[model samples]
Target: MAKKQKEKNNEVILALKAIVEEKGISEELLFDTLEDALVAAYRKNYASSGTENVRVDMNKETGEIKVFSLRQVVSEVNDKDQEISLEEAKAIDEKYELLDMVQKEVTPENFARVAAQSAKQIVTQRIREAERNIVYDEFHEKEFDIVIGHMQRKDKGNLYIDLGKTETILPPSEQIMGEEYEFNEKIVLYVVEVKQNPKGPMILVSRTHPGLVKRLFEKEVPEIYDGIVEINAISREAGSRTKIAVSSNDPEVEPMGACVGPRGIRVQNIVNELGNEKIDIIKWSEDPAELIENALSPAKVINVIIDEDTKSSKVIVDDNQLSLAIGKEGQNVRLAAKLTGWKIDIKNEEQYEKELQDALEKEAKEDPNVEKAIDSDLENLEKLEDEADIEGVIEDVDALKDAKLEEETLKEEEVLESQNIERDIELVPKDDDEYKFKETDETETEIVADEDYEYKVPEEEKED
Candidate 1:
């Protein structure tokens, strides 16, 4: 009978070795599963098993489980089932301190075959959890990129995509509007997020992701892949109009034209893949006004007036071009807003002209001088903003006061000097040779002899 028990002990080691080899897991990590399962089995047998916390350490050389039951050190050892006195705890672990949980070795004789089976089950579960974590990390790094997903099945009208080692359940909320997907159809998906769930890792994928547009461009446009062109921004309404802004590193290469391809084939293909969606290939500009104009394509832009503080761009197009600029249901301007991070308003020439007139009339009432002044101040403000040097505040009122005072003094002196010049001519000795003899005199003194000499005088300016 003793020999049979020894044989069973050897069998357990062999079974554990096979599990570690098959799962490609270290024996030490496998032992943790063994310990947890054994504790569960121990609890099922006795109510006092609350004191049981199985500790498992695998021998490095033999890869066998060495089990121990842990108990906390206590002062009075009142609940001896859950805890032991300090002296009792110290018998197993000499370095044991008060409040420390010390492990007491549990021999094979202490447990039955049920505990061994439980231990085996725990090890299997732990190995799977570790494997899932490894898979999660591998896929999480591929966020914002295109990944191929095979349709796994369906759940409540939503499609579940199987990404080989990992699966993504694409919710109906994320599906393209008015678009239908087939079963087992291979589709490209965007990895939106990854999170850890109790069962395993949950990877969220999006069918209508803006990143999908960017990734498609990277795939089709060689300039984008070669670093000659970069996708600056993208905005999409999912299976509808998608706007993408591209910037070129090479001066000669037109990034917009390059993305559009010869005969518009490149972007057209991408559009077809997105349920025949329209694509606008726009050139990216650091200037928000220019970028907004580009983002709203198929419409000629007459002018763009932007408020830097609010990041609003008031776009003016010809009356005939208004609908094209705004697009169906304001989508063109909406996409432009998203692409450039600006609030955009598309106005026809007539609407803009009327708005301009109304604004001028309002300003005339508020400040008449501003209405008289040319709108070149608007251009000047734009220039300042472009140079990133805004807010040119008035330095001081004293400077302006000094300028006004200097102008008034100069005007008074000019009037008085004119009168003095007239008097000087009469004061002369009535000959060109006597011009030097006109003496400096106080103002209002008439040097001209009455009924004797004459001089020409300049006309005075009209009073305001």
Candidate 2:
């Protein structure tokens, strides 16, 4: 019986090693899982309350399993099963201290038989969880990148792609319009998002993303991968057309020629992969006006008037190229606007002239007085000049009248000052003899003067 038991333990160890090799699971993880399963089985079968703090220790070389019940050291013992007094704990081991966990063997005689039945189910569940974690970690690094996948099946407009180790989801919104998806068809996709689910990792991929075109260019063009060429921007109308702006870091290399490859083979490969969608490769410019001009390709741009404040541009083309610049239903200009990050308005020479004339007429209608001032003839200007001259002559005449009245007032004031008369006057002769005069009524005054002396009247006051 002892020899048979030894053989059984060896068989268990060999089986664990085989599982590690077959499932790609770490041996350490498997041992930890098995020990946990043993602990649970011991609690269920041997422990009285099934709530004891139990742990399992396994010998990695011999597959020997043992179960122990843990008891924490405390100042006072409360529960005998889980807590031990410090004195009792110190007796078992001199190094034991407070809060120290002391473990005692609790493995039952029939634990191996009971644990084997329970470990099968628990280990299988743990292995599944480990596999999911491994896959999630592997694909999470691939987010925002591109991957090649094969179409496996379609369900409710969603495509399931087989990516070797896992599957990814491709929804209808990310799919190209009018493009047929066949069984086992190989295609390139841009990984949009990676989500962790309970069952597995969910990878979301796209076919219509501009990033798909960018990654394809990077893969095809050696100049781009070497950092000699850089993609500035990309705008795509999937299944129809795409516009990509590229710039060169080195002055010796042309970005357009590098991406086009020799004999157009490089771009043609990408075009074929995208179901023959048209691609326009444009040179990037730092100037907004120049960039806007390049963004609208296949139709020549005469001028690009940029409004930096509004981030908009008005593109003027030849009259014959107007329809082509605007494209069918304005698709060309729309894609150009998105690529350049600007609002674009396209017009020909005649349309632009008409727009300018209409703007002037509108301004004239809004303010009629300004229009009248601008439209005034030479006759109207001459009438205004004559009215200004008449006003100046009237001002001169008024000034002369005011001067004549002032002169008359000055003469009157001079006469009054010369009279020096009062209501009662005392006249003194040259010999110092005094004579008195009094006024009785208006215009009647008695005058007293020296008879011997002659009385003289001034010529200026004679009238007064």
Give TM-scores for every candidate, taking all chains together and pairing residue i with residue i. Answer: 0.64, 0.74
* Clash count list over all predictions: 2, 0
| 253-341 per-residue lDDT for model 1 (tens digits) | 99989999899888887887788888878888998778777888878886787888888888877667888888888888888898899
Estimate every model's Cα lDDT from 0 to 1: 0.72, 0.80
The C-alpha local distance difference test score for the whole of candidate 1 amounts to 0.72
lDDT measured at residue 351 in model 1 versus the true structure, 0 to 100: 66
Clashes of 1: 2
Task: Supply candidate 2's per-residue lDDT for 338.
Answer: 90
After the best TM-score superposition of candidate 1, give how far the Cα of residue 21 lies from its true spot, in angstroms.
Answer: 7.5
Off by over 4 Å in 2: 49-51, 368-464
